[model samples]
Target: MTYKYQLIFLGDINNNACNTIKVRFFDKIHSIGLRDNMFEIIYNETFERKYSNKQPSFVFYFGNLNHSEKDIDILKVLLDNGDAILPIYFGDNFEAEVPKIIHVMNGRQYIADHIEKYINYAFESMRLLRENRKLFISYRRTDSSAVANQLFDAFVRNNYDVFLDTYSINPAKNFQEELHHRMTDCDVLIQLYTNDFKNSKWCNEEIISANQKQIGVVEIIWPDCTPDIHNLLCEPIQLTQKMFMNEDFHNGSCCITEECIENIVNAVESVRARNLAARQDNLVGEFVEEARKQGRQLIQEYRYLVETLKDDIIRLFIPAIGIPQSYDCFDSLRFRKLLDNEKIELFLIYDDLRIRKKWVEHLEWLNESLEVKTIKKKDFELWLKNN
Candidate 1:
């Protein structure tokens, strides 16, 4: 009953994307070990009845330009209260259609299968998802460079922080060391499994490293190529000759059809969420084990860890997979109110490896003003021992 969140659907409820989002969103919640009751879905409910309070929400505003004055007013209130609202519109004249208050810099266009992109944005807004949408593309230049470049453009358009060695690595950095470091921070490894993918030294090493880290793999199997039977973490999408727009795929003109590109991108998004959840699970397990050793009793409450103490005091720990942001602090403080305990403490636990020096300094500065503190991954053992 603590820290329950809401997903509110506003404006153009009839949008096909709305219904599609609900089904997929539920799946995403389940993948992350959260129950349906932890997240309430609000649709067709009056703002006064359900959302009049200041609880944070993720709102999906659709393409319908025309909206009632009442709903518009409600949206304004939500914005003032710092609720997360996402507008989905494909048409021009976005400014003219929606009111200035509801207008965003840009809204995503609706694609049923590609709703993962929007969901990703929505979760980040709610601080349940990581701020960095990092992905690593593993493919051979000679075998699948063309298709890889096309997918890179497509993912970049969707706002993913993609790491392709040719584009992501800096000339000043060490090649092998940087490559391994880049792979460490990624949520998913999208490998273009060409005939020679396993044959390359770097490509094979990349796969080995990814599996050792237990990262999720989205395998795009090449045409006429057979995938390895091992690796339960690997989600394979076989490419037929028809999926390629270019007639000669063997000669390295691997331009995939638009539909094919969309499918692979969607697959990556789906796998990305699952991979993140798995990583979070590992973090939670490690923390729980350490807490037990320190004679601290920790219980699972929804997606967070809760430690109950005497005199109705409670400590809530939320797992932050990638970089922790300001929204994480704000959202955790908001949820602290929902618990019955008057004396409550909140913390965001995140991995500290490879985080930039400036970002860590910013987090240090940020913690001074906020009641919610962050615990770095490296300090888990010492924190457990002392606290």
Candidate 2:
């Protein structure tokens, strides 16, 4: 499968030349045994139509063997816009001295043999661009809206791709699904923590899901309120609430503020640098070894249970029902709207475990108390079976 990021190769080639180059490149790519889906190669002569559909971070130009100053200047322009060029020379018949800008590969075979090294460099550049390009903010509706908005504006002002709710995903049909998708896809998840946020089912779900997906979670904590740290799996960056309220919040020591947004940016950059360094140190190989050990441990522990569960379990869905005050929120009308009128088995959490009770006395009492037809778990299932 193609990754979230893609590679596009832009260079000058005639139809026959393009075919020959593609064949050579494809054979080299295959011989190196790299993943086929990781990169793409494109060649177009026209500058305007070069990358009309998708822009490439790395560009390799071939056939600039006899590099004139003009050719070097052109190569510099391509490199200036964050691209790498690999120039291929056919024969050493050049009387003119080659400029330092040209990377003189001996032949197609020489280029093919060292292709892996060039691609690795290209991939590293792509990774750095992805890591530094954007910041995504995730927040609950009830708490710290103003602060979140301010942070969003500040990040945008710094030319970061700020994906706050207003400018990010559109609130169309299946908006919740889109929200979850984006939450998982984002490089960072900025969480504004408050007591009300804990109470929100969607907010709690987002936080837990984001943590499980291994996205970076930065929590901006509220003053005078201790957040339930145990419930949050990721380590959160705790920023004082008073810091945000100050007009000089930017000047504070906290990294999230405007004046220190550079600090925050630098912190992320430092992390990227360190991570790259660790990868260079073969830390990823060590991690893989550790992961293999853990996998073996898991297989030993859950061998039978996993086999049994695989056979027995069909599907599972956990529906959320808010507190007694919002019992009406669980009415048939709302359930129908939420589930798109699909038939689903309903289970209610009773006594801290899921139960199949036909008629919940508490729900009936709630209907009587509020004079509304409160939808019990049994009622929902029965409605599903009948319809």
Candidate 3:
């Protein structure tokens, strides 16, 4: 559903040298474990999609400085939009115009075949800059260290990036800033509930922060004690005695036994699923706003599964506004281009396909991997609601 980057190649399609560069760049991309279909080659396409959390990294590849006027304009627009650009150039045509801060790869050695290595390095750099999925531990360190340590080990073994204050904090970092970062950035917070949990200054702060940020919280009720819920934390999962090794706490040394690990896993999964749904909601709103900005009339869109194995894909249609000169406008161009740039396949409905056959053909041709369905306008609202 989300990727680390949307690798976009932006250069002069007419440049004779770029053919080898394109082939080798794609070869290297696949070789580095990046999927080819995920990458966008913006040759004749317009820049339409907004760079957001789903596609956080917007990478651009400009082959040479000998770009067309339109290509130069697009490059400027990309720079303005804050997308990362990799300008592969050898000559001094637009070198002075290029910003000193932009990411540029040397193309003089294309004959030498080292462009792929530099491209790989740039992509790796982009990936390293992305924030990793994290889980934060909120516990009373002095009282719950034993259980926290075990949970930490379990999470690590399960391949979760965890932020336990005792293990995560560094001496050189500012305590407040680092703690805030961890609390806000984490996907889930496992609150190891103890008698001292609400009393600790740090624990209380962590709970409030998690609540304010809307981060998911799993309450692991140690010794089966009820934490005072005056200041409500996020929906909590209470682990009972049957879920653990023992209810007997001879100075708080108990182990999680039977179904408790699964309980924690299920809670995390639920939170993740909810988060994914929320993200889709946000994306739907964004796509609608984008379409409206281009003055296209939205018939309907469905947020439903295209396949059980894949995440939900949106299907929307923009019909002709019924004006005589509607065909000459960027309304359709802007609408379809936005979808194409994002590689989103949706059910498109129209008054007549013959009116925009060329554009429809281009859209279908470009995204051969995507499945498209044509529907009547009468089914729009019903499809949206049911989906």
Which candidate should be chosen as best, given TM-score against the real structure? 1
Relative to the true structure, candidate 1 reaches a TM of 0.56
**Model 3, C-alpha of 46: deviation from truth (Å):** 37
Q: Which window of 10 residues has the lowest lDDT sum in candidate 1? A: 48-57
User: Which number leads on lDDT?
Assistant: 1
Between candidates 2 and 3, the one scoring higher on lDDT is: 3
lDDT of each: 0.70, 0.41, 0.49
Model 1 lDDT per residue over 1-387, tens place: 122456888777875678889888888867754447546577656666665333335777775556522267767666544445676764665665555665532456666667897776667644454236778888888888988889888877655778898898889987777777677778778888888886668766767777766566888988878876553458889888888875557856668899998777777766665565456556666887788788887754334677877886788888876567778788888656654445988988987665556667788788899999888877899987777
- Global lDDT for candidate 2? 0.41
Residue 269 lDDT (model 1): 62
Residues 165-279 of candidate 3: C-alpha lDDT, one tens digit per residue: 8899999977776777556556577888777776668666777766554556777766546766633555466666565565643244556653666557556645543442233
Model 3's TM-score against the true structure: 0.41
Clashes of 3: 1
| Model 3 regions more than 4 Å off | 1-132, 230-233, 241-246, 250-253, 279-387
